[model samples]
Target: MRRIAVPWGVLALWVAVLALAGPFAGKLGDVQHNRAVDYLPASADSTQVAKIQDRLPGGETTELVLVYHREGGLSSADRAAAAEQVADIDRKLSLVRTPEGVPSRSGDTVMYPVASTGPGQDEKARDAFVNDVRDLAHDTGAGLSVDVGGPGALATDASEVYQSLDGPLLYTTVAVVALLLILIYRSPFLWLVPLAVAGVADFLSMGVAYGLNQAFGTTISGQSQGVMTILVFGAGTDYALLIVARYREELRRFERPYDAMRAALRGCGPAVLASSATVAAGLLCLLAADLNSSRGMGPLGAVGVLCALVAMLTLLPAVLVLLGRRVFWPLVPAFGSRPKERRSLFTAMGSSAGRRPLTVLGVGAVLLGALALGAFALPGSLKQEDSFTDRPDSVVAMRTLAAAYPEASSQPITVIAPTGKATEAVATARDTDGVTDVTRGRSGSGWTEINVVAKAAPQTAAETATIEALRDGLDGRGAYVGGPSAEQLDLKDTNARDRLVVVPIVLAAVLLILVVLLRSLVAPLLLLAAVVAVWGAALGIGGLVFGPLFGFEGTDPGLGLLSFVFLVALGVDYGIFLMHRMREEVLGGAPTGAAALTALRTTGAVIASAGLVLAATFAVLTSMPLVQLVELGFVIAVGVLLDTFLVRTYLVTSASYALGRKVWWPGPLSRRLPGAPAAPPAEEPALTRTP
Candidate 1:
């Protein structure tokens, strides 16, 4: 009666949940803000100027540059073709200002700086306009190459890439998890239960994330949403793996399925709880971030993990109990039937570490340190145009314009000033260092807009200096200088500041949580230090490969901070599982060395599977079209692998063995009783504990 009622109740609850989640989950993609200014730090001058521009007369112009070129030089026919196309664009699109062609010095290229307010402030409408222009330019041009490049085109291209990612990312992630589960379980029927539950968790997360946006005005970006999906499949599957493995073990001890699941949950529940709590607490730390995208990702990601935890802990258990041992089918764990006792890979690894714990620990440390040095080889900060892994039309256009218009501004610097100070601001901008030209446009409410062009190319170091000079020059006149170049500059600076402020906070927060859970100062610090080393080594590996092998131009500014947060948060998860087992064995009266080896032997395979699932999920990002996503995926994936095979398996086990009971310093386990039986030697198996 109990099993029957519980399974039916759990199934019914999930049915109701899916029904409610379907609608909101479908709508989550609709609220994503992928525009350049949308991702900028809130207090940035670029953000302020963009807001002021949005409230102006036309509500921000959709500006573009249409470049026409012939390799040798423009002929009579080329010039005629260029004019006819420009005229068609003006007539069909109804430009806000009719652009006159500006010819290059070599007569090989002509550029038209076209502006239109037909889209107003709607991102979708603006995308449509940019797409239309690109289509016409590509479809109509004859014997001349036409490319549309500017902020508007770049934003549209980026949105298109982001929009396309949802389907492929989901499919690829699901396939990867399914394949891994099939191999690990070696049962044709067993893998689907956990996979299906993970899918439910992912859908639930999407709905909750959408709710977060509507209620709290959380900034939902494509990047954040993509990450949430990965966490659901990755972390959810991890929890499912641990529970199912424990349930199988308990099945051998208990006669009834319900009784077996009860004992299993009681055994593994605290470890799973502590693991998820560490991950959520670390993600919640993202709230202190300055960038809207990074800050918003924290709450949304935490929601994913907690939602997954609920589904795995409640729904998966109920369903598995109802299915009974038959779900294991070809390899069922019957009542009193135990797994074959034999030598395994993890057992062999434990044996090796036992022989020379210090030697094993020292060699592993040196290898990780060597990997850490590769970070110095990484490329510089990634440019906006180089952010995408594939070359979109916008990127191609920008590259072409860069070559065609060297030492000439391809993009303008935007300045917003008080309408009363407009004239004086324009005069100051004109006389400022590095300013080649300035033009005033669009006055409304109490502010005015000015477009200034520097002699240096867009986003070049010289142009960056020019932007700073203008902002400093007009600081007292109620002016804000902003544009693509300024936004990139702000992004770089704010990421540095955010890392300085947030890294320590994340470390301290995760450290506190570990200390609380483990009830030991030395153990938590050791775990934190181990994860930090993994992060460095992983980053260094990325530095060595990202440029020469992957062809990425530069690293994303926020990559370091984000990678640190995730590695420390998620890496500590496996540490918690092992340490919890160790603690359990120790408190149950197992000697220190025996307990450490037993814990390693019992939990090693599960940690390896969980690590593979997690690393594979993040590795899915390496196949994404954005370089930043790819880089993040590579670093995190590599870091997880290192933590699994090297840090968790060997270094941690070695450190535990070498320290004896001292590893749990200040904890009750660290002190031995005066009259207890003599402890077994390190060579003996810890018969007192078993999986």
Candidate 2:
């Protein structure tokens, strides 16, 4: 009765917590900050510009361009409609500066720069303003197309794409997991257990993430929040697979379901704990990042992982135990029945690997190296306007403006000069190379806003040089240069800097954790090196295909850092699973080669299933509209599959065989057997599998 009470009590506690968490969890999406400033480096020049601009006279002004065009030429009606829309907008919103039409050389497109201070510094208000403008700018027909576009509109569009991700991403992820779970379990009833638990864990994580946001003022970006969801399902499902696999094995050993569950948790719980800890710790390292989105992702992702871990280890087990062996349905493991004896695929893989370990290693190394060359062919940094895979009205309008205003800058360069040096700063900026024009604008506190236009297009190398020159020219004048172009420049430069700072920290942290868990320098380093290779190979594949195949002209700036964090963290997870089992066998007195093969044979199916589930969950992101998410999803999914099959099966297993006990080096497992063996009778391994 007490045992029954405890299980029911655990479920009740979870239900109570979920009830409390539901509202806060729902609010998480509301708190997501997807503004350009939200994603920028905290101390970047553009970030400073954005912050300063928000405090100026009109608040962060919404800069937009109202584009109206016809395929052949602007008809009389088209021209009148364009004028009428601009007039309506003028009456509808507060203008920072009155708009005037600029026509293209071909006379096919006409654009009007509409700057306004109506939205103030509120992101929601700003988004609403963009939405309202877009609605008003909608075409009235007769071969005329109108798009309300600019930085604010772009931000709004991007946010909408991100917001759209919530429903599709969750539904797709759940469906994918459910389908995979059914196939893996081969039991209609069994699949729902882990899937349901993962869903609950996701809910709990959202609430905790919201709390963390309130307490720490963490920057909750849509991407960060999205990653938390992936972790809940991906990492959560991985833990579930390991637990359930071990539970099934224990069920065959122990007579009672409760006893089986206890034994199973005792067997695999440490590995699960250690793996989750490594992942959490790896994710937590992102707090050191300078980018708000990247930095915020760390804690939020760790929270998701931790939530999933707790739910899977406790709640999932309780549910499974209460359901008993019949939950497995037709495939249920009865206490007295032994699984069919057959030569497993992993056993054959091990035999091939053991025969030519070095050859396999050499081949794998060459393959990884070849794949890494694709990085050089990757496209340039993704421009803000080209960030979306499917071009929205904002992108289309921006593109039109770019073509129409080819000789002049489509975006302004914002400079904040101290009030004392405002005159000299304005004069210096006007004289700077590539400065097409300069205008002195809003002033408050100790600073004045100076808007400048460059001859080069935004995010181009020429503009980058122009920006660099302006900074150099204004060095001692108390001026900071920023705008859309400047923000992009800062983002690109800061991403490079962060890679240098964060990569070493992540690598070092992961290494230390692996060493502590495995208790062997060689094994941990081996695992780390293998996963790193897999990451490089995966990214190379992304480089090779992202542009030519997927038609993405540019890669996301944060792709490298984010992908590294996930791959290394997740890749090492499978490594730990494989290596932990090998060590377990070795410690129990099996020879190194025998232990490696035995571990592979026993754990291979579980690892394969877990890897597939993780890979599929991540692949769901590819269906999202955002290029970055798609690229990220594709790379990680490919990497996991690679790590699971090629790396773990052939490479790690072969290396262990060739290296012998030294794979566990300096540890007691590394020592050779003390006595020469004489076969008295044929005996099977104590831990043979069912099927």
Candidate 3:
């Protein structure tokens, strides 16, 4: 009765958890934003400009360009229609100034720059304004078309993609993981238990993330939230796999399900805890990053992993115990039953690696190094207009304007200056090289706004030079230079800086955790080296695929850093599982060579299954609309597969076999065991029972 009470009590507590977390889980979407300012650091010039704009008379401006274009040239009727549409927009919306259509040199396109502050910083209102203007800017079927593009329109399109990601991303991830689980367990009922627990963990993570936002003002973005969901399912299912595999083994030895569960926890719980700690610690290192998105992602990711850990350890065990051995269905392990054993694939791999360890290690290193060289083939940093996989109205308008007005920018460079120095600032900006025109407008809270136009197109090197020149010309004059282009510049630069700072921290954090867990210096370094090589190889593969195959024009700025953190942290998990099991065998009086092979034979299937589940979950991101998400997902998914099938299976195992007991250098396991063989056996004996 007492034993039964514990499981029921756990269920009751989880029910209570769901009740508390359900409300906040849905609220997470409310707090998520993908705004430019959200991605920027507080100290960035663009961020400061945005803050000041929010304090201006009407609020931050929603700028747009209504592009009217024709394949040949605009006729009198086309011009008239464009003019009437512009007038209609001006009448319906509160514009900062009366927009005048500027004709392209080609005579095929006319763009009217629209600016309004009425929507302020409200995303919904701003989106409504953009949509309403789009409704007003009608396309005439006879080769005359209209589009609304600008910073405002681009932001709305991005928001829509992000908002759309929540449902599809979650559903797709769940479906992928569910399918993988079903295939792995091959049981009608077994797959549902972990999937349901993962679902609960995801909800719990969302609530905790929302709480973090409310309490600490953590910035939440669609990207970070989506990653959080992936981690919950991927990592949670991994933990479940390890626990269930162990429990199944224990069930054959122990009569009671509760006793079997206790034994299972005793066997694999430390490795699970250590791996989770490693992931959380590595992700927490992102707090040192200068980018708010990266920093906030640190806590959100750590929260996700930790929540998954708790649910897998507590709730999953409780539910499994309640369901008993029946959960295994046709494959149920009966008490005192010795199961038949067949030669496994990992057994063959271990034997081959053991026979020619050096050859295996050398060849694997060469292959990974060769793959790493492909990094040079990767595309340049992604541009804002090229961010989406499917071009939106904003992207179309920007492209049309770029082709039509090749010599000038349709986007404005926004500057905020002290009201006292507004005139001087304007003169400085106008005199700066690359400046085509300057207009002064808006004054409030002691700040004056100036809009500058450059001779070059948006996000190009020439326009970047102009923005730099404006900053250089206006520096220390109590003015801040910013705009969409400036914000992109800041994002690129900040991500580069963040990589420098966060990468080292992540490395040190994960290495330290490994050293502590393994109680050895050499093993930790070996594992870190293997995972880092995996990262480089994974990125190199990305370079090969992203441009040549996927035709992605640009790489996301944050990809390298984010992918490194995830790959290293998550990749080390398989190493920990393998090494931990090997250490257990070594402690149980097995020779070093025999232990390595046995560990591979025991843990390889579980690790491979976990890797597939994780890789598949991340692969779901490839279907997302944004190129950034797709790139990130592709690289990570590829990395996990490489780690699982190659690095863990071949390189690390080979290295361990070659190193012998010395793999545990300085630890007690490093010492020669009593009566152990002087060297590892040339071939290992086949086991009689399932490991």
Report each candidate's C-alpha RMSD, comma-separated, in the order given.
Answer: 2.8, 2.7, 2.9
TM-score of 3: 0.97
The alpha-carbon lDDT assigned to residue 325 of candidate 3 equals 88
Would you list the C-alpha lDDT of every candidate in the order shown?
0.88, 0.86, 0.90
Model 1: runs farther than 4 Å from truth?
139-142, 673-691
Consecutive 10-residue window with the lowest summed lDDT within model 1: 681-690
Question: CA shift at 669, candidate 1, in angstroms?
Answer: 1.9
lDDT by residue for model 3 (494-611), tens? 9999999999998898888888888898899999999999999999999999988998989998999999999999999878888887777777678777888898987788888999
Pairs in clash, predicted candidate 1 = none
Error of 1 at 189 (Å): 1.3
lDDT-wise, the better of 2 and 3 is 3
Candidate 2 per-residue lDDT over residues 1-691, each given as its tens digit: 7657767888999889999999999899888888777778767888887788778888787888888888888877778788887888788875677557878887888888888787876777888989888877888687888988878889889988888889899999999999998888888898899999999999999999999999998889878888889889999998888888878888888998888888888778888888899999998888888888888999998999999999999899889888899998889888977777788898899889888999999999999999988988778999988889898989998888887678877778889988899999888988988989999989987889998989988788888998999999998776788888888887778778888988999999999998887778889888888999999999999999999999997888889998999999998988888888887777666777887888889888888888999999999989988888999999999999999999999999988988887887776556656453422321211232324
Candidate 3 — what's its lDDT? Answer: 0.90
TM-scores for every candidate against the unseen true structure: 0.97, 0.96, 0.97
Model 3: CA > 4 A from native: 673-691
